[model samples]
Target: MTDTTGAGGPQDHESDGPTGPVIRDKRRIDPETGQVRDVSAEQVQETAAEQVAGGDNAFGGGVGDALPGGEQDPSGAPQATSGTPVDGGRSADDLHPDTVVAADRLEDLRRLQAEYVNYKRRVDRDRVRDREAGTTTVVEALLPVLDDLHMAKEHGELTEGPLLAIADKLETTLGRFGVERLGAVGETFDPAVHEALMHLPEADLPEGATETTIVQVMQPGFKVGDRVVRAARVAVADPA
Candidate 1:
């Protein structure tokens, strides 16, 4: 039997035997019509080769097309020039412009804060030291007056007219500034406030106890605000 199928026709081998070769041409389908037509394999291969070459060309030119003085975009897409702004309406440098200035201002503020803290501490320390020095000076000046009172008492003249009055006034004035005297006669002997220059034996007093009187107060001591400027020099009783 003679084969009837053509090389490039549809349904040409339908009437032939089941084992006969059927040649179906490749064709682009019309999406709206669903119709078929004849096309050569060489033509399909050539069109595929052209698409591959075009893809390579597109890949190679992509960056150049996006830049200035490069190929114009064939698809009419918008392109950026060298001077164009970025997405946020700002240039590259504007994004980080304030960083240095902000850092400098922070350094300045830190320096100023440190200086202020040091100044406050210095002023407070100076004020405390000055108050302590003033207290020391006042205590030093009152020692001579106390010596005079002792001298007058030894001579049995401390109770006379203006001298007693002056002594009372001086004590009252010094008392206002936290001055206090120690080592009085007949008071109990305390080592914390008294310095024993000599001990005298007394038969009437209890053993190891201070006797009736302080025989002598060589120098009077004064305290200011709970701080002793000098220790009193006095003679204490001795148990026989």
Candidate 2:
């Protein structure tokens, strides 16, 4: 009989195996009645499994052992696609993707919220400042008018009629913006808020006066919020 062992087709012999190099003889000389080497399904399956596993069928070791590449991934992890399980079971991590931490996500959300809160506070502060500045400018321009109104009222020129009503409404409007008059007779006068044009004798000072006192307000001063629009022009009398 002619030796026709591997004549059937290609043989499954892994030249490289774990432990050492593997040599499979495909000769046609059977111990019983050797002619052509016969290939069995069981032998084929065993050989294929060994080759797929790579090293020891145990792990043959792949991230996805026997899955796909059956080789190591970029992270140095043995990678394998979905396939028959290797000799040993693979860890869950090897089968799935990475896990995301909820704490990290929450921290990021809180940080963004804090940043928005700070921005809102800053904007509110700027808005208040702008409003105060606008009020101060308007009050400064109306200082002379306010003085005329005060003088007229004291002289009984605005005791009644539309002029008195108009003055009252104007003053009321300015008051809403925190505008107020400065300087009054007998009030302690300070250089920061009072412009003194004349100084009377100490003898003319009001009773119990310890500091410079305003005896006459020639022109009333006005202010908006904490900003002085104009200083009070007045005559003063020093303490005895």
Candidate 3:
């Protein structure tokens, strides 16, 4: 039950059930007798203090998780030990001259891409407008021929013949290209669209009429879409 421990006096140790004999390294060499001595209380306390301060000596504890001073680090992450340079030792915002130049070139490339897109769109739009203008000009030039055809038809020269059929086909084909006739005798006169070639006296105006009215359409106008190619020439009757 009682045993000596190196330089320490006899101390009691309890039996750990029916197991084999336990061995303890409590002996040290005696200087005078040249024999082993029991360990002291002071040495036991020192060993315990060393184990608490340095963590588990027999089995590693908090080996890689802790810093040197046993104090909790602000961040448990390992500190950078090597002096590594980024972007050739330049700050992130103030990058190296070559890097800055490359970035500026990239920005210029982006700006050029945007400008090119805008220019292409403008060119496409102008091309469409030019095509429409060219079509409108050609159509306007043919108006005189159409007028002659109308006059001939009205005079009974193209009655139920190939000429009348050709004229009808021409008109229908032009309509498919957005060409439309403008002018009606009973409609109100608008100076923007109707050209008054003759005006009747106020006394000759129809009953209940107040504004200028188109009495006769001398020449029918032509238009394409919302654009007027030519104004309608008409005889107007003005009210008193």
Query: Which candidate model has the greater lDDT, 1 or 3?
Result: 3
Best model per lDDT: 2
The local distance difference test score of model 2 is: 0.77
Q: Candidate 1's residue-wise lDDT over 112-138, tens digit each?
A: 999999999999988866775687698
lDDT of 3 by residue, 146-200 (tens): 8998789667898888888899998998887778887776678888788999887
Best by TM-score: 2
Computed on alpha carbons, the lDDT of every model, listed in order, comes to 0.70, 0.77, 0.75
Cα deviation of 123 in candidate 3 (Å)?
Answer: 1.9
Error of 2 at 59 (Å): 31
Writing each residue's lDDT as its tens digit, candidate 2 over 10-87 gives 333543322323687644477677576778888788777877766655564544655445566678766554552443
For model 1, which pairs clash? 200-238
Between prediction 1 and prediction 3, the one with superior TM-score is 3
